[model samples]
Target: MDQSLKSPGQSALEDAFHAMFELTRTKPAPTLAERLDRLARLRALIANNESRFEKVISADFGHRCATETAIAETLLVLGEIKHAAKHLKKWMTPQRVPTALQFLPAKNRLIPQPLGVVGIIAPWNYPLQLTLAPAVGAIAAGNRVMIKPSELVPRFSALLKEVISTKFDATEIVVTGIEDDISQAFASLPFDHLIFTGSTRVGRLVAEAAGRNLTPITLELGGKSPAIVDRSADLGEAAERIAYAKLVNAGQTCIAPDYALVPEASVQDFAEKVQASMRRMFGTDPANKDYTSIVSDRHYQRLESLVTDAAAKGARIVQAAKPDDPAWKTKRKFPPTIVIGVTPDMTIMQEEIFGPLLPILGYKDATEPVSYINRHGRPLALYWFGKDNATRDEVLARTVSGGVTVNDCLFHFTQINQPMGGIGASGTGAYHGEWGFNNLSKLKPVFYRSPFNRLADLYPPYGAKISRLEKMLRFMS
Candidate 1:
């Protein structure tokens, strides 16, 4: 990495990292007051520009739902900032731990220290929330932050950069350019910690680059998260909730239910209910502002292909809009589609469907869904819907996912106290509220030795006295 041959984006990134690294060395731990001030500035930045952010994000997506942006992006970030600001003092305090009886006179404490500069690589979906929420935790832990917003949402990314520049110093918190060169170089920087939110395919690249620098990462990747509809579950209730979750961002959500698993007898009924629910919520019009369009033409075409592939493979394609409807294609609005009788070989079932398309699969018994999920890579989120406590408990215990909502979808992520992350193929590491604070902060343990402790007597000079102590220790154990 010679400076002379480096791209402008790489050079700028190196400069930013060096400046922030130097600042961390000079003033590593910011005071409580300083941290609170930073949080306040972030709060004001979001509050003052809420409307503008909504508009820019919509422009980026062609037609992003305004209410969805407010709820999923702006509101979530504001809530995270408020949570971090309120409980920061308690979160930052050192904790006491019990000492072993062998070292009874010593004291043990765990201190939380900042991890210096944190880098966040955000995706275009929910750009504001995904980018700033992790920064909230890093800032709360008193660390400098650098964010690389998605290139897909150029308007939103540029607006974020300009507004962030106005409120904070570059070294304190900066938004990097979303150039291709910048994106490629961002993960390679030797950050103290990195947070990436995107598909599993790109998460691997980011993780590999970060691994070279031994930088810790919190990856929020997507997967084929499933919604299990138990036989005892209320079909109407489950359908409405899952439908809302699937269509919220036009199914661009990472944790959105990728497919549904219903009992064999109820498969057709559940599919109809879900389709009806989708129509009721978003309606049959592509021009409906309440409905959001796919982020780009490429993404829209991909969704169309998934539906086409499923249909060609003998899977039922239920849609509110016809496949060749020019209105939907021109507007980049993907018709809410439900795929029935999807087989494992279908491309739609083989990959994560980050669109409004939902595949409805039927299971023979309670154990079939669990086994099916286990056979594939673990999902980022899992949804179980049923009133039977025994069945719900069994499903929860048998399945291993990043997180779970017992009878709902996407609600677990909103709980600030809970860790929002995935496992294995879904993601690696967790963050949100105290979980985020602790993950970004190093919990260094401090042990205080008392002058009167007798443990030193057993060091070296082995003899009868040490032998007698060992015998006593064995007896105690």
Candidate 2:
């Protein structure tokens, strides 16, 4: 936490607050074309700074793959910008509604209005994408934005501050790099809408702070997202996809499959296949330059502790490869770890294992696995690997989550049309594509009446006319 950075962040936030207020209150609402142009500019800004963003992320995380940054952050942000640009006009247009027969000469419409200043608190996992994605929606909705990138990724945070400061003014868009206290102060600011993406614990604190101002929030929190493997599923493909998804970014993804529920008869077989796939992906040594390392030493220690605690409690630990060199340990490079026979009482099962440790639980039947999933708080994402459409439909219909994928993992979120959000504890509110625009805009209903159809009879004091109006209402109903 640099004092110099903190000071500028505070000043930037205040300037952003005033700027947003002025833009929302005084500036004429931007037309659909204007909104699209703004999004286009954002796209160019991100594309132009892609290399710098990747470099900053790599410096922050120690070994972030540039390709991963492109796919997860840069490309994703660009895609969001393009999606918003394509749909802005239609999303912004006022929708006409049917007027009641009693108000024959009246017309009704639903108009969307921007919610002024929107604050986005993004986590370090996907720093650039998370910050820019929501900001795209806010801008597309004709609102100003202030972004607070996680201090954990200091290099990326600094890079974002530089890029944003150079590209846009504080009134239109701004980014902050600050310490914990400064972060808290930024969260406490009264914004029209706020979006925070992080762990559920921190999300609760953010929600509490935002509640003070009655600010609407879109919380994108992570939980123990599960992957269920049915007896009839293609074990080879499932193992490959699941392994790729879990090991990507060293399993730091919010929507990555945290654990698997495999059939008792196929547990051993699935484990073998998963181990083989892991070897193919990362080879015998995951410490090689090809593999991504844990974000920091603190997170590495946390994962090690979880593994140690689980092992002491009689959980079987299996690693994809053995670490033969001292360099691996010092670099915080953890091999893809799989734990078995884990009980609900274990620490790994109790908390979100946001690392490379994947747990496998054996169930006697599909019903048992489904019951187990339902017993837990709804997750942000659910992955089911099966071929039967009926079985998939049954699970889909019964299971509750923010998003779901059939015969795959973590890909549902890539679709721009489908809404992504969670039920119960995972999170609240959906944002992406049209959903994003809707989240930042207020839909106000308006009714217009013609002088010819001004029903004065119904406006008078209660009398025989009221009875006649009631009769007419009944008829219309």
Candidate 3:
């Protein structure tokens, strides 16, 4: 149906689409100044609502730390906005290219233009950052944006909607709440581009829906990312970093270290250090206020099931908290856990464990881990810990992952200059920094024909002259 003739009672999805379409028709390409203005507004909105955003997101999670919110969500987006604002003018400028000798009087240039409407669908984990960071890129490219945040985090979702609504015009940016069937319609809309960040299962469905509209999409899906501990590594420091990365947000992160490949002889030592690190970070059983709880009861049960299935399959389950600790009884808090002797038949190894569960797989050599990683789908991130440059180089060259962090974990995602994304099953396409601006924009090529051109010499009357010109052109370079 023609959007212009849609019914009065059309779904809210239609309203958002029509609003952005009408607005784009009025202002096809925003000026650089206009783009900067939008980014500035986004930064200010987060700056002004830092405390409230922390409070609401904590309410969404059982209890998220205000500092974590500030660092992961608020500060991250703020830094992105600043980076974009500083370089957007350069990104938007037309780039010149060399014209071929055959077209001596012609000039070539590439123009970057917005792709009308960009739709961003974010997940429950890192709700604020996932939703807004992409918006920062789309806005930098001067596209009208519509964001759909996960409904599971209702408090953050509602607050995000409220914040965007209060600070932005409906035609410029719209935030939609999770309204069941209406969301299906949102994905199927003929958007210029779409970005979905979540599970690989849902990513397939979203891709299928967008395919019907011939809409280009960017998928930021999750996978079982791994951390490799080499023979020469500082085992204690590796355990500390890995534990912090896994336990943050209760391991409800897309790039969290899902498992580790430790040297066979040092597996027990590494595991012990990881337990001590967990104790120091969250006290006994993670009862401290700093540790975040599972986002929902359903997820809590799912994590429990992963642990139970693994244990039933002969995996040795080590509890960081005291046995039968009351912390696990809570509807939200799932204590830190580490699994050993895990096999491929177990459920934990088969899927991306999006909770506080870590599996330590023993490896005899560096190539063993590389071969193991290659056997499965590509991970979103990979971590290597060791001072042996030769071993690190071999691991780096032998394995393929979306991104890598050397001697540490999860911090590779902090570099705004580097593009952050997944590969193959983990995800498709990339974004962040200049990569994002280019992803959302269409880099169109324009050629100028000089009036004094001699192309008429080889026109339709082509015979000997045309043959000579073609042959000469082939060898001209």
Pairs clashing in candidate 2? 402-421
Where is model 1 poorest over a 10-residue stretch in terms of lDDT? 322-331
lDDT for 176 in candidate 2 is 68
Q: Could you tell me which residue pairs clash in candidate 1?
A: none
Write down the TM-score of every candidate: 0.98, 0.95, 0.95
Off by over 4 Å in 3: 1-10, 322-324
Residue-level lDDT tens digits of model 3 in 1-477: 676665443466787788898777777699999899999889989999889888888888878867778888888999999999999999999999999988878999999999989999999889889999999999999999988889888888888889889889988898886877556777888899999999999999999999999999999998999999999899999999999999888899999999999998888999999989988887654557777888887888888888999999999888865323565556377778999889999999999999889999998876899999999999999999999999999988988888999989899888999998999999987889899999999999999998887788778877888898888888987
> 1 or 3: which has the higher TM-score?
1
Error of 1 at 318 (Å): 0.4
**Residue 248 displacement (Å), model 1:** 0.4
Instruction: Give candidate 3's error at residue 264 in angstroms.
Output: 0.8
TM-score of 2: 0.95
RMSD of 1: 1.0
- lDDT of each candidate versus the true structure: 0.93, 0.85, 0.88
